[model samples]
Target chain A: MKKKDVLLKALKCAFPYTLPILAGFWFLGFAYGYLMNVSGFSFVYPLVMSICIFGGSLEFVAVSMLLSAFAPLQTVIMALMIQARHLFYGISMLDKYRGMGWKKFYLVYAMCDESFSINFTADIPQDVDRGWFYFFVSLLDQSYWVSGALLGALFGDLVHFNTKGLDFIMTAMFVTIFAEQWMKEKRHFSELAGFASGVIALVVFGPQRFMIPAMAGILALLYIFRRLVEKMWETGEDTE
Target chain B: MKMTLWQQAATIALCSLSTMATRFLPFIIFRDGERTPAFIRYLGRVLPGAVFALLIVYCLKDVSFFRYSYGLPEAAGIAATLILHKWKRQMLLSIAGGTAVYMILVQFVI
Candidate 1:
């Protein structure tokens, strides 16, 4: 990949779809920053966390864990469990990730859902360089997060803004992703079934148990109805 | 007591440690791992919706059915969001727009 092309791909990855992620990075960083400042930590709290511990939820939890004096081992366990979903991502991404160089470690390290989601689709143009693409994606996403945190920590005193509505971005992002997937598959049973099962589980189990059960249910449902799912899937592909 | 630069750095470093822990599966990117197993593919298939659904609740966990967050307007904003998201596939617009509407309601109507 020529230097020129790499720059181009990095720019391409920066705009459009990445905007939502950037927004998230901003708010999450800002909130983390506010919390750190109020909780009696310095700017370094948010900065180092953003740069190194880019894990979304865990970072928030980490703040309280420190204030409350949690054991390091406990924090480690909690972090692993909270982000355990990434394990699933690793399994699915094996094929796509199989051949990079030194960048491989960082790429894997930076494998958050946002990056994975973006990468899951879009033809990784043979002409474009993967490393540059990954670098931009990782760098931009991290920047959004870190910068947001840093900014929030520095100027939190002056700001009295309400965050009442900001959290919806996560929900909105997911809806967008799900809708896109639905559009791609177009009313396929497996997709619909999974979605339906997930909703039902949400209502029944409430929020706490819904995710794991619903995910497991979807897989089982697909396996049970493999023939029908395949038929629908084939039909979907044919239409495409 | 005010935290020093190094202490802040180290403390946040501890915090960031958890993030890495979650993201910390040892396998290198683009190497060594075989095709995603069927189970993982299954996890991927359902995980998005399931997780999203949970996030919706988590975000609104404080909003009570018997009561409202910032009152009726904020409540309406949420419903408007769900409707707009479902009706029009405009997520960013719906969320931002819905939030703005909620903010307005809280500011003026409430």
Candidate 2:
């Protein structure tokens, strides 16, 4: 197969994943835009932030931070903690993306919820171009985000429809993702691991400092019980 | 009481920059292959644990815990939801149920 054909085929394979991502961005971006506008910020500011920073939770937190002056360390810590999930997010994708060539960096960088979904679902066609598939997904995901932000910013300023429960969209999105993952293999052990580690951390560190430690404990358990863990899931059929 | 337009612009601009920079930073700094590098790999493995920590806790940040706390009602609702999630294995239903229960408590029962 010609290399060019491979790339085009890959692009076609990745087209469908863009829909959910676009939907998420539209809702999420709308919420963020409304928050910023209501908080006394302007449309252009959010428009730019959506384009550049693109971090949803952080931006939400940032509206308050901007109201007050925070030290650099405080700002950095807030951003890091909120995004701390990405660390584990990266780990799962390690082997799958090991050989992406020039696209490797962008692929890793762009691995937000949407990007991760399509990529995790990716099955590189032996004869088709996986590169184009990846590139298209990445491009489409970013476009959804940028477009959604701008749209929200434009509409949010003029229209103040009651957005009371809309803030829960991120929570809904995460829950949906976790449920989907759970369904794929019913990896009950990981769920148990998550629950156990959380309870332990909650007891030890209380609610405040539990995150970092709980994460450490869960990973440690996964390592020590790697064989047992594998056996637990080995019974379930592979999602593939 | 009134914030000027550029002030709004500045606020949003700063916010947008801060948020994007945080999400995008490590991606640009670290190579994808180096995801296996010690620090990055450690983070990757702990992803779920870390996120679970944030999710569970952050949900509690706004409301106070004691002395006629709204959080108490909300927490009760959330706890019930969590239990339902584990037993029934229903995501949408659990959340809707929990949120509805909390809303009822907040609205009437207190």
Candidate 3:
């Protein structure tokens, strides 16, 4: 296939996978932009932050951080904590992300939850270029978020609509991914451990600081049961 | 708003830097040719399911059981997503349906 044909085929394959994210990111990004607009910042903040940070939750948190007294150390620490999950994503993608050369950098840079989930799970057709497929997925998802944030920041005051529960798109997306993962794997230990540990951490640490503890708990539990979990997958008994 | 323009820029830059650190650290630690540690490779295999679960919980971290809506809209929305996904296996339909359900419940019913 020609280079353009391969790129076009990859983009065509990638677009369908990103449609859900398009809706979710636009709604959430618009909300972030609108919030920033009302908080007295110009459209520049969202545009730059969305492009730079690219993590939706952290960018939203950064809005509050920006509003508060300037504390660069706190800002860095908070950003690290909020985005710690990307560490797992990076590890999981280490092999797959290799060998892409320049595109590898953008893949890791724009490794938001939606992009990571789609790139990791989507089954590219045999003829499609793997690197270009992943690139389009990441690029399209980022563009949706950036455009949404730009729109919200620029025309937030002009828009008037009831979008009270529109943010649920994200939660729905995550839930669907979780469910799909559940069905794909035979062993439920990791999934169960994650759910139980997450709930426990949330209950113990409260919403303000549950992520670190939850992640720690997950790692510890997964490590402790490493032999057993690996055995389950190895024996093939864990499958449905 | 309280910070000067430079301070605001510094803070945003720090945020971008810190976020980049987390995303890049693993690849940096285990360079291209070096053998990744066995335990780390094990983690790569099993960690995704748990991480996805954690992300789902993370998204819902702000919900309050004792608050005004009592988390009903979230619960209903998730339930709708579960059902829709289980039935259709269509990603867009499940998300759109669940979000629409939540929007309605919060807008009028709840």
Error of 1 at A123 (Å): 6.6
Which DockQ value does candidate 1 get? 0.32
- Which residue pairs in candidate 1 collide? A97-B30, A98-B30, A99-B30
DockQ-wise, the better of 2 and 3 is: 3
DockQ of 3: 0.83
* Candidate 3 C-alpha error for residue A201, in Å: 0.8
Q: Sort every candidate by lDDT, greatest first.
A: 3, 1, 2
DockQ of each: 0.32, 0.19, 0.83
Residue pairs in steric clash, candidate 3? none
Single-chain TM-score of chain A, each candidate: 0.83, 0.78, 0.96
True contacts kept of each: 0.31, 0.15, 0.86
Model 2: lDDT of residue A130: 64
Tens digits of per-residue lDDT, candidate 1, A48-85, equal 77678777776887777767543556655666556665
**List of clashing residue pairs for candidate 2:** A6-A129, A7-A129, A10-A133, A49-B16, A53-B20, A87-B44, A88-B47
Interface RMSD of each: 4.4, 5.2, 1.1
Give the distance in Å from residue B29's predicted Cα in candidate 3 to where it truly belongs.
Answer: 0.8
- Candidate 3 is graded, for docking, as high
For every candidate, the chain B TM-score is: 0.70, 0.82, 0.93
